[model samples]
Target: MRVLFTVYPNSLAHLYPVVPLAWALQSAGHEVRIAAHHSSAELITKTGLTPVLLGDPDQPPVRLTDDCAPPHHQDIVNRYADVMGLSPEGREHWIVFYQWLMQPTSDYVRLDRSEAEDLIEFARVWKPDLISWDATIPAAAVAAKVCGAAHTRLLIGHDMFGWSLDRLAENESALKAAGLDPNPLATLIRPLAAKYGYEVDDELLVGQWSIETMLEGLRLPTSTKKLPMRHVPYVDPEPFPKWLYERPEATRCECCGRKNRRRVALSLGESTRRFIKGDWDRAPKIIKALGELDDLEIVATLDKAQLADVEEIPPNVKVIDWVNLPHLLPTCSALIHHGGIGTYSSAVAHKVPQLVCDVEGVSLLMRLVEDGDVNKTGTYRLGWEFDEREEGAPDAATAHWELPAKKVESTVVSDFVISTGAGVRLDHRATTVEEIRDLVWSVATNPCYRHAAAALHDDWLAMPSPSDVIPDLEKLVVQHRR
Candidate 1:
């Protein structure tokens, strides 16, 4: 059977999750091709899969405007929250973040009509047996429908999109009462679907089913039938640097005396490293403060761009541009990182304790931008708390005073870490360097964190690996394909 894979071309983060499974299908003698924007052709080739380019490499990237997003996005979010009966804090944790997330899939932003037509034309010519796409790409669903192919979303994290669509369906009466269409996903896809001479439907929007890498415990409340698989970490292959294997103690007399010192992997995750320009002011501060510990060696996976603000490199810290997490994580005592699924899953797979930091503030600002407040921006700071007793709302203490305390993905992962006793979640935006130092030390030295991490590792190991789940995927394709 021929299988076609598709993902949004915005980043490799979306592409990486599906590679292992694509490889698994290929190993089982199926033909597989990855279709993405032309910009990602090189990356697709790097994964050892055939590439199907969908759009012109020179085309300006698709973008959404503020005028197009806010009102409709907020309405859908509010309705979904109402149907879910979320609490105030629950709304903050997920719904608010999702409102900001809705921009990407909004009516404004999507694959160019020409690019999408390109995909549909390819599907027609290729007649793929199945189309597995990133959850963010609804146009692939349209192509699958037009081509009579089975389709499923390949989720890298939580199933927020699926969950929202499910909520809308389950509360059809309430939505109708409110004078709204229950199937917002279908509504969003209608313009494109109509072009293909088909009416929009749930199967095209949500897929016949989905494949997810998140453990069952981390899953959201969604009615979509999903198959769970263990996340296999894959990075663009890089040659090992000679210094990586050499023990630091051999080169410096100072390191030889601190035999008790532990090694910690410090990274801001790929999204931050690739997308965030300039250093996050907090990165240098955290590295320097953690470096002050006499009993630690910090391996910071950061490039020169991220370290531009640092006046001095700490003697105990080794800053490198890149190192594969699967290679370096096993040697580390703990991980301190932005809560990207790639980094979080790598640490869990390697049984390393973790300290996950703030990701919500940026999402909060995203809400402001979508609401047409583009000029309102602030430097993200750590360590503020609101006194509940004094609240209606607090006055601005600094630039962009109201920062979100949580982002949906980070909060979910961090909560699981805390619940399992495997790590700590640094929730405060205003957390001090001293506080971070203590948290890092606690998770690294505490055997409880190690035991908890091992337990989590055992759970992760129990999930079916890519190669192990090949039969299930084949069965599903057989069952769902026309």
Candidate 2:
């Protein structure tokens, strides 16, 4: 079978799963082609798949222009200098803020349309049997419709179906207003029925041929409820190495050349950094905390800009600009992150205990932590509060009062730390010079935390790999193709 995989170009999350799936299909002797932004072409090619550039050719590259200064600095500038005066809730204020923040993303999406048209043209020529797509890329759905192929939506995070329905409906309305059909699922069955000169009910089109049909086609196990809204599925834990369970004491991986077996990993994705900046002095805090640790090796995956910001590097800290985390994580201790779903899932698959630091409500890290799937570490700036004296000044006092350092409700850090097989949740109150030094020493030198983390890792490694249970995801693909 030949497959065309379409994905959103904004982030790495959409690209990761596609790579593994493409590899799986290729190993099974199927031809797989990828359609994405030119920026992601290299990434796709690295996975040994052919990349087809979609959308506009003349679109300019996007740049990050926000002052690398802290949020307080930016807020001050916005309040004193900008006309909006820090009233983010106001329509005009939001318009300017979002336009500034999202300008690059908007430009990228605009370019994506031209690329999508190119993909549609390619599909016309190549005539693939199946199309798989990241749910965010509507263009993929359009191409799938144009090519008369079966389409499956991949969810990178939690199942997007439940709370996403309203957003989907809104998008559908916008597309319809723009004189497009808006429903890719309808394009297939409705067009065929039209060709036979028959009328079809829209409800049946959506219920039978749209969302429900697509889910059924995927061969996903059914939930107790019939409605999509009631049937959001939990992500299954990922599989790890079998040897991890047999030998709980085994920290070093013989297969991969990793040593000094601290099992925890940290993902410093861009969004997480932004959130941290809003709350406190991120750079100094991280440096202070990490500097105190001598026994445990702290591995941080950071971008070049962030790497450059580190003035003094700790001897035990290993900094890599990028890594194949799925390949690297099983060898580590636990995952400490600003909660992104991709990172969360990767940690879960390895059964690595999560110390989540939520920077934004856009990501559901807090929700997951509250549910006991992962341990929550910190609070986010929900929004700015207002004061009567200064109209635009941030309600800094409210933020200070409301935001907890870590999300774990327990009074004892030891209990929270030892019970979950994860590291100590850093208390913002205790994040002063002396407290940071003590906490880092405690986490790094503590044997119990490592033991708990290793035990969890062992449990994760014992699970059956998808290869063992599903054997062939292609069968699911083929069934959906019909």
Candidate 3:
């Protein structure tokens, strides 16, 4: 069977999980291709997949500014408020749900209309037996409907899309009464689906099935069929430094390196470093905080720009412009990152205690002020900014000691870590330098954390591999294309 995969054109992360699956299929002697805006064609080719360009390559990207949708869009905000009642828990969940769902939908709507049109037209020509698309690319469902192909939403993190689905399920009556379509994605993709004579529904926004990369228990319950996939990280294959395969003179890959010492990997995924047009600077302060611990070596994978403001580099801190996360993860005691899917997945895969930082994509976590001085629409500014408006889920977890996996993607991993007694939610805003010092100390010294991390590692190891899913997908195709 021939398979085609699509994603939101500009996202580098969206394609990672999809690539491995495509490789698995191709190795099984199936023809595979990647379809997206031509801008992504070269990236797809670099992955050793056939590139099927859908939209115009030269089209400028669409971005959302604070001004793009203003207070006048009270209908959007009020509608969300209506869906989530007056209860504080409802409001909190709404904040988490709304920011995540709306941000992407904002970008998706602005995608050149021709992007979707071109993809649909290509599907008519290619007639792929199966279409597995990034959940962010709503157009793929429309294409699948037009070409009579089976389709599924492929996920990178905990299914935020599923969270939206649950909100709909919880408030079905209110949503229906308001004449609101429960799925924001459906609302985004419906017009295009209608163009192809496909009636918009939940399935169109989601898919016939979903291929998820999260570990077992963390996956949200959803109406769509779920395929549990072990997130085998596929960084561009690289020759590692000799020290990676061979242990350093003073360090080991086990037990936080040297028997008496601990090494924390201080790193951020690419997006976090460039977050919100590179507005707020947090890396230097983070490095200095981690540096205060004497019993440690900090292996920070950072570029010169991230380190530009740093004058006094700690002797124990080693800074590299870049390094493969898989190589670095196995050698560290704990990881501090900006809650990116790839970093979190790598941390879990290796069973390293993780400290998810609130640098980006954490909206509701802001310190709310009594006088309505919430830090909304700001980019990664540190320090406590939220005040209790009306007590709901009182007492948030500490940022340095534990980071909540609050975002749609991080929640499952965060929950898993906390559930196993392995880690905690990090409140970046309120955490002081001393707190960060203590947090890493606890994560490194605590045997419970190590044991829990190991158990999670085993659970992840037990999941089906990229190659292992081929037979199941083959069966799925047989059923779908019948």
Candidate 4:
């Protein structure tokens, strides 16, 4: 069988999820090729997969300016909400996602028309029996359709695309009553579909089926048929630091003469460093707070850019620029992160309790407020200006979501983590340095968190491994392909 995978350009977040599955297919005697922007050819090859480059390697990848959407974008979203009788909260959700994530992604994917055209042309020539597309790049569905190949969405996190389609259907009546398009997202790709004498529909918008990696409990309700698979992280190889194997030395405790310290891994993740221009504003504060815990040795995977604002590194904390998470996770007692799926999954796999610093609040506007005084659009700025709100402002709700994941994605992960008793979520706005310090200490020393993490790991293991899913995928391809 010929299997082709399509991933969004630039970010490996979209690509890494597919690697283990591609390897599984290749090992099963199937030809697997990953289609991505020419800029991503090297990344694809690093995974030991054949590269199907989508554009000329000579030209620089497209760079979209970071700017607010026009005011009219909000007006249209508001109009849709008003027509649909959505609450202020629901309306704001639309505005926040439409402006920050949805619209920007649509624009980004559509900007490089040549990339999509190239992928479609390759699918035609290669004649792959199946296409597994990154959920973010729905254009791959069109390519699959044009080439008559069975397609499925490959997701590393929550099924936002499928969930959005479900949401659109629920709002169909309200939208039709308002004389608005029920599926604005579908409209975005209709032109591409039309170019090949096809119409944008559910199959083209979602896929024939989806290979879902999120643990079942954390998944949102969606109509798409899903093939559940375990999330096996595939990070770039890095030489292990010798010290990583050595146990952290016991530290003197004020009350107890000396105590063996537990090791905690602090990784805020790559999205903030590469795309957001800065780590979460409260990151330095969290590090310093964690550093104060004498019974915990913190190994922070923070780059110099993220540590630019820090005045001093605590003696208990060793900060490094990068380490493959899977390499460090096994030795750690607890993991503190910004809710990046890679970090979250690694912690789960290693049965390490996690401390996720997700910003809290249902309202996007409320979460972005700086000290409850001014609205700040960027998350990197939320904790930068002030750590606490004016004395009377309601304490920020438990940290729920952060960038990239948005509300739906972050909420699912946090809810699962908390429900499984595996870790705690700290509100970036409301948590003080002391609170963070105590939380990290509790997660590391507490046996209950470890037990819960073990249980969670058991659940993860129960899911089918990538290789285990080969037969099911083969059946799916046979059932769905033209």
State which candidate has the highest TM-score.
4
Instruction: Order candidates by lDDT, high to low.
Output: 4, 1, 3, 2
Off by over 4 Å in 2: 61-113, 166-265, 270-280, 307-311, 326-331, 359-482
What TM-score would you give candidate 4 relative to the actual structure? 0.86
Tens-digit lDDT string for candidate 3 (1-482)? 98988876545677766788989999889989887766677677778888878655555333212222111132464566666563553444454555544544544434334767777788889798999987767777778888889888887765656666666778878877887765565666666666677788766777888887777676655666788778888676667898665432354446465446667787766643433222134565666677897677788887664565666688778888778888987878888776677877788888898876652344343332223212222332222212212212222321111112233344445556677776765555557777877887888778888888888889889999988988888888787762
Compute each candidate's TM-score over C-alphas: 0.84, 0.56, 0.81, 0.86
Better of 1 and 3 by lDDT: 1
Q: For candidate 3, what is the lDDT?
A: 0.66
Look at candidate 4 and give me any clashing residue pairs.
none
Better of 1 and 2 by TM-score: 1
- Poorest lDDT segment (10 consecutive residues) of candidate 4: 382-391
How well is each residue in 1-482 modelled by candidate 2, as lDDT tens digits? 78888766534555765665566567777788988766666667665679887654454223221211112223322322233222222322222222222222233223323554577679878988777665445445555556666665544433323222323244665555555444333343343334334444332222212222111222222221221211111222345435333322324556885544453455655443333323233444665566665545567776544454456777666666565566666666555664444554465455455555532212111211122211112333323211112224333323321233332212222233345655555443445767655655555446675566666445444543323322334554455453
Name the TM-score of candidate 2.
Answer: 0.56
Model 1 earns a TM-score of 0.84
Query: Over the stretch 1-482, how does candidate 1's per-residue lDDT look in tens digits?
Result: 99998877646778888888999999899999998777678888887888888766675334311122432244566666676666664564446335544545652225343568788899999999999987667788888988889999888888777766665666788777877667666777788888778887778777888887998788876888888899988887878776566544433336465356578888876644332334446576787687777678889988865676678878888888878888788778899877778889999999999988765434432222223221122222111111211222322322222233333367678878888999998743467778878888999999999999999999999999999988888899899888
Ranked by TM-score from best down, the candidates are 4, 1, 3, 2
Poorest stretch of ten by lDDT in candidate 3: 394-403
- Which residue pairs clash within candidate 1? 382-429, 382-430, 382-431, 383-429, 383-430, 383-431
Q: Comparing 1 and 3 by TM-score, which wins? A: 1
